[model samples]
Target: MKTIHLGVFEVAGPQVGGTLSWPHPRSRSAQFHDLDHWVHIAQVLDRAGFDFLFFADGYGYPSVAGDLPETAARGGINFPSLDPAVLIPALARETERLGFVVTSSTGLDHPVQTARRFASLDHFTRGRVGWNIVTGASQNTVAELFGHTTMQAHDARYDQADEYLDLALRLWQTSWDDDAVRADAAAGVYADRSGLHRVEFAGEHFRSSGYFTVDPSPQRVPVLFQAGTSGRGREYAARNAECVFVQGTTVAHTAANVADIRAQAAQQGRDPASVRIMVGLTVTVRPTHDEAARLRAEFEEMQTDETVATLYAGNTGIDLLALDPERSLEQLLDRDDRGPVGQMGQSNIDRFLPKDGSAAPTVRQILDDLKGKGTRGFQVWGDPVEVADELEHLMDAVDLDGFLIEPIFDPADLEDVAELLVPELRRRGRMPQEPVAASTLRERLIGADGYFRRPEPAAASAHREP
Candidate 1:
């Protein structure tokens, strides 16, 4: 058995089903649960041996088909905007070991602001915070907020984000000394003035001319996470990210992706092992195989088609609500072939349908397979021992660092995993029992017991191993 890290994506509000008219609020506690309900749930995950609670956020709802606000309002989907990073401090207060990862797009805000916010979070949490780096996917986000009529070209956005990251790196990594902050009550000074450094950067997309206002926090920088899987996105992750998130249906596809990413990391002059790749997994565990299958069946029956459709529509950028059932996914493929989503158009289709076999799955088929794809990273729905066996197989096959656990149900679903699945992993010597030390997020991720050290290279190279 091998050790693996695990994370869960926690969304605000009730989860939407596949279609608009279908049941939008799928949570049984929709009537009783609110935002704070999620806060308490975060606390639960922290105590349940989860490495982190990763949150997926969006500035605008799925409004590309027609009017934006109307669709969001009618569906009651992701409308109310609450910056997920703001909620980290609250969660940090409730637990000691669990980490927090929140999405913040390079397109939505300036690098200075992003740098300041995440740096503050790292400080507040004592280093248990990660930024899920994203370039906004919607055109409406810019049009409504930034007064832009259309989105920048996909490749162009990545280019801008590249510069944005460079600027942020300057602020977070190069701006202050490790011992810059010296709290000396006798000297009546909190931070040593001489230890501060200024970074001067001028780029096509972003520019910074002064010293960073904040001193270096624990970990110096927050743990970096990237989800895009395009060639350009992979290169960006190789150069900048500590963790790369991948999603796919089959183990072979995921293995190929992991290999590709590690190869890229090696080329970037960084230790390939330094870049931890985590794939999303959805698990349904019970005491016995029969019980687990029954629970999985119950979840599939409860899944809402509309909710899944809304999510798919948002990703493919073709409003499934507006498309005819006969139209092929090939028709929606962008000619320029850029952006993370555009690059993944075919892969996403393949995850739902057959590759070179079907044009694309129907809207209903996509919703029907939601559970399967949700577990595409790896699905383990069975008795504790059976699920553990599958998990070990996946780890050996892909050399995966861990899984991004997506609970098909609510927080209770997490409790079930904790009760049934975690112990099995521990029994197999695949997961640790003791909570990680109260340390920085980076420290917890790659440290020994909970201490930081310079990253080391992988044991074998692409050619060396193969």
Candidate 2:
């Protein structure tokens, strides 16, 4: 049996995206800004032999036509979004082996700024850092928040990202050399001047013409992760991402996604095996089936209809409740009565639009679908053995690399996973008996020991040239 990788899908707010259960008995909503709370969760996951904690973030909330919904605010939807990148170092300090993958946008941060920030994080965590490369989520809302008059089209942003990532890769892989640092005390030499290279690159969207200020750190470039599944997104992931995150609604959906990405990666001149794919899963495991079912019932009860609708509106920037129940999603977007539209998440909105002459899903039908799963679709409910069996089957069936264990209840549910689910996996030879503490995150994730080595000087670089 192959050991599966695990990561907790987390956000530093009242709730994760698109779920409305802040009032659940096990919710950590009261401690969204509490560092000790995060520290405790990090320690728990580290002890469980999980690989990383993945944070999904954006600077937008539920608003329509410049109007904020009272339900989203009162129900504590994806509002009060905190910066997860600022919270990683504290969590890293409290754990030994666990890595962290934080979401950051190419549209929001300049390449030089992003490069330096991840470099600092890499040094702080001793190589346990990864970047979830996002072009934009809730782009219109984010663009408005950042004072942009208009948002770029979906594919256009990905084009910008290609340029942004190219610059960052050059800075991380080219600016320093193997023997750049030499702390020779007697000679009073700190760094070998000849070993440090100053880089200059000009691209369509980004440019940098200077030496990277930070010295070489372990895994100089953070593990690259991407979470888009559109045509453009798949291409971006194939060409750039080492890990791809997908929230597949079914086994077949996930399997096709995995196959497409691997094939695209091959076409991009990459090793198909290098692009690892992960799916979102929310598990409710217990000692028995009846008991797990009972707990799952309570979780379902917490998702009231209005709150659920409010979460959908906030995330997609369409106030479905205020619109006609019979109107299709595409029709609603084109309605003159619709409010100020932000371009935060095009892929999310695109999923609902009609293709060809096919009829689009109506507002009422979309609401019903939200009631069905929304963000919690790929979940499993059962005791330890059953959950582990499903996991094994999914990995084999879909060719998945791992699962993002979205907590049914943030830190509280994770405890159950650590205690019940992981031990069973270990017993079945589906997990390592002992985890090595000293391996860098890249080594732990892919078992590639020397994969973090630097590239050749920029003069003969494989990356895009200036």
Candidate 3:
């Protein structure tokens, strides 16, 4: 049986799922700016035998509500964010086994800088690093932060990302030969110059002509993660990603996504199993089922219609405030006849629209749905055993490799999972009996055969006898 892999999801800001979470009495989100807070969480998760800590990031505050930053800032909706790359080294130093996955955008960052950062982080973490590649999703972010006068069309962004990954892969894989470094003090040689090669790449979106400066880290390349679900996005992931993050409102929806992505991988001449699918999950657990229900009720009460609207606007680039809440979504879609507009627009549509393509829901219905569940993925509210059972059921039903646990609030939500949930999972033999012995993140997540294998140098292959 496959050991169910686990990871914790977070953002380097006060809020995670929605704005209301930050103000909860038990929440320590206010301490997000403090280094000790992150270090403590890292240690806690490391002790709990988590596979990784996945940090989601964004470039700008939410603005789709009024095309202004005030709503996001006033609500503290994903504002006051910090760069995950800056936090990784500190967390890495505090933990030995837990991996770290940082979200970086292909649209805003240069491949050279991104390659060097992840390469250095892989070394610092002893091969426990993964990169979540995002094509910048927010139009406000594109205009205000990345200095783009206009957002690129959805498919065009993926086309640029294709070139971005091509350059990054060349830098990671071919720039430094496996045996490039020879630190011999007596010979006074730090590196063999002949083993290093320069990469000259010129594409429609990016151009670079240089050798990578960092030596190969333990994994050589950080484990590649992608969360895009559009046709172009899936194609890119199928060709390049080692892991894919997906969110769905139901088991069948998630399962179908997994099947589609795997088929895409096979079509790209890659092993479908090599790419692990991690579903998003949220849990609110207590010692008893009744108590858990009470907590869920309280959480639901804290949510508001405005928070739901702002989140929707931020994600889809569609201002829900301007639309009549009483009208059906199909009516609005037909009247405007506008397709998905942002990078994440299609995904947001998929999340909100009914699977059967029947009559569309009203704006009020959508908000009510979000209030009940907040966002996608499996949501469980129960005692530890019940939570574990729900997780197991979802894993089996969807054929998922793992879950990225979304915290209702930082530290508190995660602490509950570590203390209450993990033990139950272990008791059921759903978790590993011992810590994974693999030295690298890729191996730990998908076993030894799941890592990237570079082609052998021609000279080295020729020297070996048949």
For all predictions, the C-alpha RMSD in Å is: 6.5, 3.1, 3.6
* Per-residue lDDT value at 152 in model 1: 66
User: Over the full model, what C-alpha lDDT does candidate 2 score relative to the true structure?
Assistant: 0.80
Candidate 3 local Cα displacement, residue 92, angstroms: 0.8
Better of 1 and 3 by lDDT: 3
Candidate 3, 171: how far from true, in Å?
0.5
Error of 2 at 20 (Å): 1.9
- lDDT, candidate 2, 1-466, per-residue tens: 4568898899889876567666777777558889998999999999999999999998877775566678778877777778999999999999999999999999988899999999999999999999999997766677788999887777888889988888787788778776789989999999988877877776677666778898887888898899987778889998889899988666875688789999998987778887788888889898998989888888777676677677666666676777789987766557675443434444456656735466778878877766736655477889999999999999899888889998867787899999999999889887887755756788888766553432342322333223
lDDT of each: 0.67, 0.80, 0.78
- Model 3 agreement with the true structure over 1-466: per-residue lDDT tens digits: 5567898888888877654677778778878889999999999889889999998887755666336456567767767788778999889888889999999888777999989999999999999999999877555555666566666778887888877777777788777777879999999999989888877777777888877899999988899999887667778788778889887677887787788899999987778987898888878888999988887787777887777777777777666667788875555556554533444556766555666767677877888877645444667889998898888888788878889988776788888988999888888888876666678898888775533653432211111111
After superposing candidate 1 on the true structure, give the runs of residues whose Cα lies further than 4 Å from its correct spot.
16-36, 68-81, 139-142, 303-306, 321-327, 333-377, 448-466
* Cα error of candidate 2 at position 116, Å: 0.4
Model 2 scores a TM of 0.92
Q: Which portions of model 2 miss their true places by more than 4 Å?
A: 330-343, 350-361, 436-438, 451-466
Residue 115 of model 1 has an lDDT of 93
10 residues in a row with least lDDT, candidate 1: 457-466
